[model samples]
Target: MIEETPQEVQVVEGVLLAHGIEPRTHWFEASTATALEAAAALGVDVGAIANSLVFRLDEEVIMIIASGAHRVDTHLLGEWLGGIVTRASADMVRRSTGQVVGGVSPVGHPERLRTLVDVSLGAYERVWVSAGHPHAVFPTTFEELLRLTGGTAALVARD
Candidate 1:
């Protein structure tokens, strides 16, 4: 297990503190890079794991916090956003969010990104999200996620 908190995760903790939230971070020995891994490590349903997805809309980068059980339909997302949506390159993801692909948190981006939170996540009372590290995660509610990321609630996933 990683005994030390990563600097990236510390930044996320700082952001959460700035938002008046006490960080409750969980670190795992194995990589919780994927939603399934995170769910397994946390002993929660897959749907309760919030997946932070980065996409490119024209020249802008956007974030979609979708439930682990769902897949973001890029075509539908593009239609809703009035532009085609493509997966953001790893470099773009890192530069825009100041974190690695597997560890991107909803907060602590270089700038405020346009974010969409999947309404499906509302089914769970508590959800787990990445805490800026592949081995770290934090529990949060759907409403809290919306508030923290300034994200609009939407149907971002495919059925």
Candidate 2:
């Protein structure tokens, strides 16, 4: 675990403490979609990575905390959101969500962005999320993330 803590560490820590969980912080080298890279870097299971994905819902941006094992069904989400859902570009991601692709955290945005969680993530007892920095990550439970993000848990993935 890296002790320097991330710039967005405050948001994660605040949310965790509000929920009565004192989580331990960990940092990694490369932050990417390849959960294996993060896992190998952190020496944890690939399943533990919580990939913070952002999509354009209509003109608004929406965030989805999905398990590393599943891919988001953007078309389904678009239908649910009643608009065209598309994968946000890197510029769109930072502009709308105030975070980067791999280092996007479930919280600490400029404001609350409408968010959701993959129901499949509930299968995990704990998950790792980006800590507002590409080199930082931290652990939290699936339930905690849903509550913290104020996001509804739904089937956002499919085979």
Candidate 3:
């Protein structure tokens, strides 16, 4: 287990606090690097785990908070956003969000990224999101997530 909160998680906590949210970050001894791992750790359904995915839409980086049970259809997303959506490289992800893949959060980026929250996430009353670290996560409702990230609600994933 981490002896202290990491700087990345602290930044996420700061963002949460700035938005009047009490950060209840959960740190795990084992790696919560995948949605399945996180869900197992939390004893929640996999669908309740929100996966923060970074994509390059043409020249701009965008974030999509998709449900763990779903996979994003990049072509569909591109049609909706009017750009070709491609999976971002690790370098691009780090440069854009200052967080690594499998640990990217909805907020706490160097700059506000255009974000979309998967509408299917609304099915869960409480959803767990990565708290800027592979071993950390936090709970939030779908509405709260949208408000926190200024994200639009959309069907970002394939059924």
Candidate 4:
């Protein structure tokens, strides 16, 4: 069972509420670092995991919400956005997202960052995304994610 709301959970709750989303956390025993492991532990499909990835595009901050079953096509994304897309360094991630690699959430960031949601995830009725903490996740519909984030739905990841 999860606590009512931990300190780290507060920000996530706030973000979800502000977005008019119904978010709840599910606790698990597996490491939240990788989708494959998380999926196995949770007994959920890999596609249900919405990975929060940070990428640097022309030195600007960009967030990508991709399906666990896929990997981002940075080169294609670069061409689509007219800029080079590369993985953000750990320092850049900390400075921009205020969360580590495995537990980055698309919302409640330290500051606002550009966002992109993978269109492939739209096929699912709902998707699971990490909260601010590893082992914590919440469910959100694809439409809600897109609306809340004001993110473009794109084929940014390869399935």
Candidate 5:
């Protein structure tokens, strides 16, 4: 079994520590790029995985931390944000967050992008977030997530 944390994850750890949170990076042999994969790898519910989805609206980058169990309703999100939202491209994801799509963290970016935390994620006592790597994840709470990203809690996904 191989175990190595990616440099992006290390950067995320530094950001977490700087914010006074102890970071614990967990790497699995199985791929954790998707909610199903990550949940299976960690033996946790899919909803407990926070998917950091990036959307592009003109010049603005919107990072939506959505529950893995649901899909983000772009229409609703756009209405809530009062801006049109489009799926971000791979290049845009890397350029904006300094990380790839599957491993984008809620924090530790080249710049702070606008973030929204899904209210559904708050149902879980502990949630897992990407640690800047496809095979890396870290534990965090809903409140901590909001604090870290200064994200507004909203119904980002349709029920």
Candidate 6:
């Protein structure tokens, strides 16, 4: 049975289902706001955490599904995406994804935004991503994310 989902998470769940992916959101008593926190809660490697990050690329808003183990290098990300990349403001984040900073998901936006998938995420068989709520998360695989978002696989971080 599916857990009772908040409206925000329901939007994400619908998107996942529309893509033919079925996943249940796990709600935690504590916050899963950060990748480290989420990984700890799930008892998984940090690399298995998929951080859905929003960025302002030139005039467009984009999403980068990065692995939790490393930080995304905005400079390199811009070069790869062929645009100037900068961190989206709180307002921009909310406006673009209709989700807060800590609860952004790879899908379920008002419109389809350009997305990039960090290649490092492929190292793990399954990854956990925000489920449109800070206290909620859902399981997915790298290939599924790529397929769902129609994202490009790229090296988004620096060592």
Leading candidate by lDDT: 3
| Steric overlap count per candidate | 0, 0, 0, 0, 0, 0
Whole-model lDDT for model 1 versus the true structure?
A: 0.93
Give the least accurate 10-residue stretch of model 6, judged by summed lDDT: 1-10
Model 6 misplacement above 4 A: 1-4
lDDT of 2 by residue, 1-159 (tens): 356665566766676677777756665546543566677787777767888888888778788887787788888877777888888899988876566777788887877888888887677777878776677777778787878889888778776
lDDT, residue 28, candidate 6: 93
Q: Write the per-residue lDDT of candidate 4 for residues 6-117, one digit (tens) a residue.
A: 5556787788887766668777766776888668767789988899999999979899999999999999999999999999998888678777788788887888888999
Worst 10 residues of 1 by lDDT: 1-10
Model 3 C-alpha lDDT per residue in residues 10-91, reported as the tens digit of each score? 9999999999999999999888889999999999999999999999899999999999999999999999999999999999
Ranking by TM-score: 3, 1, 5, 6, 4, 2
Which 10 consecutive residues of model 2 have the lowest summed lDDT? 25-34
The per-model lDDT (C-alpha) reads 0.93, 0.76, 0.94, 0.83, 0.91, 0.90
- Model 5: per-residue Cα lDDT over 1-159, one tens digit each: 445656788899999999998889888878899999999999999999999999976568889999999999988888877878899999999999999989899999999988989999999999999999888899999999999999999898778
Query: If scored against the real structure, what TM-score would every candidate get?
Result: 0.97, 0.84, 0.98, 0.91, 0.96, 0.95
Q: Highest TM-score, which number? A: 3
Model 2, residue 158: C-alpha shift (Å): 1.2
Question: CA RMSD for every model?
Answer: 0.8, 2.5, 0.7, 1.9, 1.2, 2.1
Collision count of model 3: 0
Question: Per-residue lDDT of 1-159 in model 1, one digit per residue for the tens?
Answer: 776777888889999999999999998989899999999998999999999989999888999999999999999999999999999999999999999999989988879999999999999999999999988999999999999999999998778
* Higher-lDDT candidate of 2 and 5: 5
